[model samples]
Target: MLLPFFEWCENTAIGETIRNSLWLFPVIEAVHLLALCLLGGSLLVVDLRMLGVGLKGQRISQVAGYARPFLIGSIVTLVCTGLLLFLSEAVKCYYNTSFWVKITTLPIALLLTFAVRDRFSLRKSFETSAMSRLLGAGSLTLWFVVAAAGRWIGFS
Candidate 1:
């Protein structure tokens, strides 16, 4: 059932149109990389601030506020291109464990972002509280796992 849906997608006008474009895949992939960089970089900056590693003189909310746009932009770019890429190989990715792990971790990452961000906004200190710091560390670890799994998917 799903196979046909994916096949149909691959054969659809839009898919064919994108497939025919000479630089579409490369361009989208480059954008994806750029987005990943921005997301990781922005998050790290904020996390480091939380950990008292970066912007030590700055408030956590201030640092996070400044980085929010970059995070949002990266997420938008990443999701858009990621969907396109997934559609291009939907059936395969649908069954890939790494892809699933990546999917699963996304919510955790989002939750961490909201929780930490909200706390900071609520006048809470961000001086690397044990829980928040753990969350940050876990966030980084999970994302790394997601990327590693994504790479492994190609091999399998």
Candidate 2:
């Protein structure tokens, strides 16, 4: 079932164009990297705030508010570019272990960031709690692994 979908993705016009154009693939890959960096930076700011390390003296809500737009935008950009990159090499990715690791971790990390960490960050009571610290640390670790796994895909 999934094999057919992967095959279909590889046969799509955009996928074919990406694969055939030597420059297009590299350009998209670079965009994906830049988007990841933006995403990581934005999340790091919020996470560090949650951990009470950075932006000390500022309200958690205030710090998070500053990073929220960039975080959301980067997520959208990364997902779009990531999907395009995946389509360009669907078959190879289908068999890649690092690809699977990244795919699995990406959603988990996103959920930890947007659902768990963001919710806690918005509540003043939870801002300095142990739970907040744990969530902050976990989010950072998850995203770090996600980025590492993504790089490993190139090697594998």
Candidate 3:
């Protein structure tokens, strides 16, 4: 079932172009990395504020609001470049455990961000709540795992 989709991806013109070009894969990979940096850096700033350790003067909502746009932009860029990169090696990634791990963790991390973490940041009482701190720490940990698994995909 999924095999045909992977085959189609690998045979697509975009995929073929990426696979054939000497610089395209590396360039996309670099873009993906840059997007990852933006996402991670922005998320970290907000998360650290949740943990009550950084941006001491600003409210949680203010800090999170400042980072939200960058976070959203990076997510879009990373997904686009990542999908292109994946198309070039769809069949290989389909069988890669690290790829599966990274894919699985990505949605979980995003859910943590938008569903759990954002709610915590929006609440004025969250600053003193233990659950808020836990969510912040967990969100950071999930994102870290996602990054590690993504890197592991190259080796696996």
Candidate 4:
């Protein structure tokens, strides 16, 4: 399904134009990297709070509320730029193991976010439970793997 869609994209005039631009991929990759930094930074703070490592005075909900916009913006930037890059090398990425690992981790991280969000409550939000700390550690590990896998794409 995705292959056909990607094939169509590869054949389109827009795709041709995008592919022909010598600097487009590099520019997109740079933006993706910058977005990654932003996302990681914001998530790190949130995770640290969850792990009882920082901002212990502030409520978890308060921290999450403040970071939500930054997190969403960074993720949006990452998605758009990442898709552009993937489109440029769709067929290759479709088979790359590192690419698969990175793609796989994305959903896991999202699921982790949903789990953490669901676990958050008025009273519970104030207390960083052990489960929350474990979840935070898991989220960090998954993101680390994703980043490492992405870097491996260059060599593999």
Candidate 5:
């Protein structure tokens, strides 16, 4: 069903231009990676805080709140660049297992990021700490899979 859309995307002018360009692809990929780093770093701080490590001076909620905008911004950047990257090679991605994996996990990661934030920060219950740790671990694991699969797309 979506194959036709992918075909259309690959044939689009933007995709053709990027795919044909020697330098544009690399430059855009670099920006995508930088956005990944920003996303990972911001997530790490909040996850680590939940894990009972790092920034002990600040509350977990504080760390999470601080990282929220970074998360949102980096996500936006990643999605834009990622869409360009995908548009350039939509057919290739359609056949790539790693791309499929990333696609599957990415939405879950996005939902978990915000849902966990709301649950972790807004709750006053004592179990919030344990719950935060659990959610943090899950978020980290899902994101790792997403990142690893994304990287694997280059190799596969």
Candidate 6:
């Protein structure tokens, strides 16, 4: 159903330019990876706090608040660079199983991070619940699959 759109994206002028350029793809990929790292780190701090591992002294709300800007910024950066990267190889991604895995997991991961995890972490009370540990584990697992699938795309 979406194959035609992927074909159109790969044929876009900017996409062709990026695909043809020696440096553009590499630079964009580097930025994308850096953004991923930033995102992982930002989320990790809060997740660990929720798990009652690190930052025991700080409130979950405080850790989450501190990581908010970084989380938002990294996600923005990732989306921008990811679009450009996809534009360059949309058709290839369409055929790649790893790409399907990434696309499948990415939104779920984001939903967990922002909607469930972030909101849950923001309670004023310092009380840690069993749900917190579940959230932390689930967030980590989904994100790891997303990242790993993204990495597998290169090999695929």
* CA lDDT scores, all candidates in order: 0.74, 0.87, 0.89, 0.78, 0.87, 0.92
The per-prediction tally of clashing pairs is 0, 0, 0, 0, 0, 0
Model 2 lowest lDDT segment of ten: 120-129
Better of 4 and 5 by lDDT: 5
- Residue 154 deviation, candidate 1, in Å? 2.9
lDDT of 3 by residue, 1-156 (tens): 788999999999999999999999999999999999999899888888878788878888888888989999999999999999999999999899999899999999989888888877866655635775787799899999999999998998
Off by over 4 Å in 5: 122-128
lDDT of 1 by residue, 49-144 (tens): 666577778776777788888888888888888878776667777678888788888777777667655565335465557665676676677677
Give the range where candidate 6 is weakest over 10 consecutive residues by summed lDDT: 120-129
Candidate 3: stretches off by over 4 Å:
none
Predicted candidate 2 versus true structure: per-residue lDDT over 18-72, tens digit per residue: 9999899899989988988899888888788778888878888788888889999
Looking at model 5, which ten-residue stretch has the lowest summed lDDT?
119-128
Question: Which prediction has the highest lDDT against the true structure?
Answer: 6
Q: What is the TM-score of each candidate against the true structure?
A: 0.82, 0.94, 0.94, 0.86, 0.93, 0.96
- In the range 11-84, model 6's lDDT, one tens digit per residue, is 99989999999999999999999999999999899888888898889889999899999999999999899999
Ranking of candidates on TM-score, top first:
6, 2, 3, 5, 4, 1
Tens digit of lDDT per residue, candidate 5, span 45-102?
Answer: 8888777787766777777778888988999999999999999999999999999999
**After best superposition, candidate 1 residue 36: deviation in angstroms?**
0.8
Write down the TM-score for model 4: 0.86
Task: Name the top TM-score candidate.
Answer: 6
RMSD of 3: 1.3
